[model samples]
Target: MAGTNLQTPILQVDHLSMKFGGLVAIGDLSFTAPRGEITALIGPNGAGKTTVFNCITGFYKPTEGMITMTRASGEKFLLERMPDFQITAKAKVARTFQNIRLFSGMTVLENLLVAQHNALMRASGFTVLGLLGLGGYKDASRASIEKAVYWLEKADLMDRADDPAGDLSYGAQRRLEIARAMCTGPELLCLDEPAAGLNPKESLALNELLLGIRRDSGTSILLIEHDMAVVMEISDHVVVLEYGRKISDGSPASVRSDPKVIAAYLGVDDEEVGDVLVEVGDTSVIEELDGVAPVAQGPAETSSMFEGPIADTVEEAGGETIVPASPAASKAAQVEAETAAKSPVEPKGPAQ
Candidate 1:
């Protein structure tokens, strides 16, 4: 908030599209992230969620549309036009992958120090004179070390500064990845599944670390996570994506209650109304939304939209098996799932 005026959004993604041969990874997606907030992008497997992140971070140039980031200093960057390094170097965007990519052979401190290599080189005057330690190279190097130590302290990795990165635990490795990104001094941090393989305790630690980053460092985070617990706990807002399109965007509470979201999860047609009523009970309100007529009938009157082939699909995928429903009930769930997938737009007010 200190750097951003209320007038412009921090990042604006407009009609973004991407393709992989015959597959459409992302389709005409658009959204905005404000100056200071943690936004979570969530979806089931193969949702094109990662593809969108890649496009924004310059890993994949979009087939169409624009990704614009307005910096705190009121500078505007067309992220799609820039190369990957420029996305980090000039646009001040940093990222972490789903898989932790650390310099396994390097010391923990050395890994972080490397993140600030460009800054330190500039400080040393980038010449043979500086390399010979004549133009404050020693002082600059010392300062770089101190900054790396500072981030390590922040990440609670100071104790392992002298250790090889490969020697740390899985959780520590994830934390170090984040610390390394912070070393670059980014304004926007894009994390891809930071909690993918962590145990319960490790996942909770990640939650705390992410919260700390937001509270103390003022860095806005855009994360793609499948861990619902992590998403529900820390995200200020949640966006849901399915296939290649955004379906829902709102607070956690609003998204959880959306009928479209339920249907998406269950993978059923909306016309199968009465099937869900038995599970959810008297879902007449939901039925009305899907334009289905209310049914007054016996138990066997329900249709089996979720039976047979549907059940087999769910079972094979190791997902929950939803009972069959009337046309209204099925529609409600689909509607809810889609609504739940929509990501929250930035609040049109001052940053907290």
Candidate 2:
């Protein structure tokens, strides 16, 4: 296979739209994800972010628009015309879900082996040639095992390859699921909320694995993440979505400081100011990010943001809520989320 074009886009969504039962989920959204880079798609819960992913990945036919995907081999596939299976098999696009989608009962190695089902089936000639004593099937099976082992090593789960996927820690399971997807040999990998519900340490591990995928495997990645820390830390490009429309697209630093992005997050919870530190270009604004102002609609319920295990309490100083990332890191996380809602949309911008 030819190498990916770093300067050229691997995926392009042109004026894409999706509607269901008279309600528009996405509206004339257009964006290009460059090859061999991490691109993040971020938005509030109902901003129709996942709808855009669905349209691009062929889970939805799309109400209108084109999803053009250029492969490493320089073949262009119109994804909108393809089914989900064809998109995965032919276009070489693979995706992981917000929720880890693995067969919990299956061993870690089995999950990856399952990802190679198409390849193995082909190798077996649909079992017809295999029954007729095909010679290559043995080599093909061995190759599949080698591929599975390679990904297991990459994920650092080689020690648990024989263990049930469910037996691994939450973070390990996340890596295992990603390894299964990588085993499919995708040119473009789409990850949906890969950091959801993960601890800070687990999030760090996930970031490293994703970075390895981009740097070593040379697979372009598209991500939908609410975790600003993860998004900014690894993404080469950022695309912001609001109500299914592209709001901002730029380098991480540029998007992090855009007033539009700040306001978009503010719209999520006007009173909650925990993320204001990222809302502006200056770090001096950190003092202003305290306490949640009561909104008439109440706090908007959204996906996990500034969230993790609730192991501590939000402290109070002089009747004012103090958001802590203090010595008690656990309490600080809670305070951060208390001041911000579940889906606090702000970019940390690759900074600690």
Candidate 3:
């Protein structure tokens, strides 16, 4: 048998399992994130998405399996064996949180400089030589400041560098968080809901920033996002999870049309499969012709706007709140609705 190529996935999760007493947050999960690509892990609330993030980032050790990451310079790290700092220092995997976690009291530039603390410490040799002004700590500090400034420019936060982090707008704060993560010089960047709260312009800015990171830095990204436009526009690959298990994994197009994925997001049972197929097929065709392929394109892509009985069912059963549509999201939904109305539909037939 031909073995799967492992030249080294930027991040490889193999049979990873995590439990909190009786609750199995992640169960036998496995996947690979290719280098220089954006891979999105998305699921409804309480699908154990954040739990998996914590495990990979060293907030919790896995109950089983391996999490491996290969650096640009050919260094391979067993992420589970390393502490959080080693995960950052050795594996070079950096992350942002679901909620913005900036040093609210600190200046924007200061928040970024703190991320390079380890590098600065090492450059100082942890010795009195630095205290005696013999070491190059001063120069190292200057270099760190330069790196922070570079990222601030990339995030478009250079103008606000001297402002308190808390003083920036919601979207600015989100970008600042990403800049701070990049300051760590990670090979793999993990973002948990970077677009959780932002206007359309801000979200688009984020999309551009992420694309720039991929294009210029060759950095691979793993993100958990509920924003359909952001996910559809930027992600090269997508993974859908429900109830702590993998439901679908593929390109955005493939996963969107997956029946299992549709049902998972809609919280419908197998018995209602025919109805969903009928509805999705009808709406999708209409949406396609109306030039709103973005909405009719996939289930997970459009379910964010659903607030009917199906949405309620998902909330009750999945034990997670349905992420509400942001103002930008409503525009996307309006476009989808128009598409559904204008596109033609086909008669429903038995599942092929």
Candidate 4:
């Protein structure tokens, strides 16, 4: 809810594409996460949301495009060129997985401490100084413990500090994972479905924790979440993906109201599309049914990313002047006839 610097982007993804063999997982997708803001990437399943995350976090090399991370000190790193480990270690980018990735055998406190391994290793001179308890190792060890304890309290896991991470409940494990990532002192935090299985209360707490991180530490966050409640509440910007392409990008309110987004998510049966367009305030589509060409409004006027009957509906409404299908029943009958012809041998009955 607080203001963030929209002009200064902490991460820039430009024309990014990823391919698995012949399958294009992400295609020419571009978006930005501004410094100290919560940006959410959301879509229906198989929309390539996770693929974009993988490319950003170095889990997958993009087939095309640039991934740039700019730190507060003005240091810039080309993330797509970095190894996964180096992305976290040198570039100060940290992420949590869709599945929990905690060290199950380790204590909750130890899990947090392990996230600080690079710093501790530097302080200990690898292991010799640490084993000898000499030089700055003692001070560094104390500092690591202090940091671990700090995050544990923030995550509300201090009561279970000595318990094995595996022993915590599902929600607790989720919080612990975030706490572990926070211990790494990340400049950019990428979270994959942090609220996937959380109850209402846990989800509320998670929202508070994320907001606190942004407010107190100014850490930039990019999250992939299906929980619209969380996304709508915390996100300053929202980018939508559908079938490996970005379909919408704007503030939560704007994206939520975009007719293209509505069609993509709810899906338009050809029979219902004319009404749906009108319902979403795209009344100009009805002009097509009345024989008047509607004036172009924007890029969405003649372009669409949907498939099947929905695609036909959007294109017809926006693209060309054609014979009027004025009555809803006439449009439905036309679609049913086309569908029947495509599959001739199917059992024919009243349509569901």
RMSD of each candidate relative to the true structure: 13.3, 12.5, 12.5, 10.7
TM-score against native, each model: 0.75, 0.75, 0.74, 0.78
* Deviation in Å, model 1, residue 352 alpha carbon: 72
Q: Model 2, residue 132: displacement in angstroms? A: 7.5
TM-score winner: 4
| Candidate 3 residue lDDT tens string, 16-73 | 8786643456777899998889999998897878988999999999999999887777
Model 1 lDDT-worst window of ten: 305-314
Clashing pairs in 3: 286-343
Q: In model 4, state the lDDT of residue 351.
A: 79
lDDT of 1 by residue, 1-352 (tens): 3555855767888998886543456767888876678888888787788998999999899999999998888888999999999999999999999888999999999999999889778877876756677777788888888889888987889999999999999999999999999889899999999999999999988898899998898888999998878888998877787656777788877766665555554344545543553345334422322322222211233322211111111121244643333334334444444334443666698777
Q: Which ten residues in a row have the lowest lDDT in candidate 4?
A: 305-314
Which one wins on lDDT?
4
User: What TM-score does model 2 achieve against the real structure?
Assistant: 0.75
Superposed by TM-score, candidate 1 places the C-alpha of residue 242 at a distance from the truth, in angstroms, of: 0.5
Task: Write candidate 4's Cα lDDT for 120-216 as tens digits.
Answer: 8988999999999988999999999999998888888899999999999999999999999999999999999999999999999899899988998
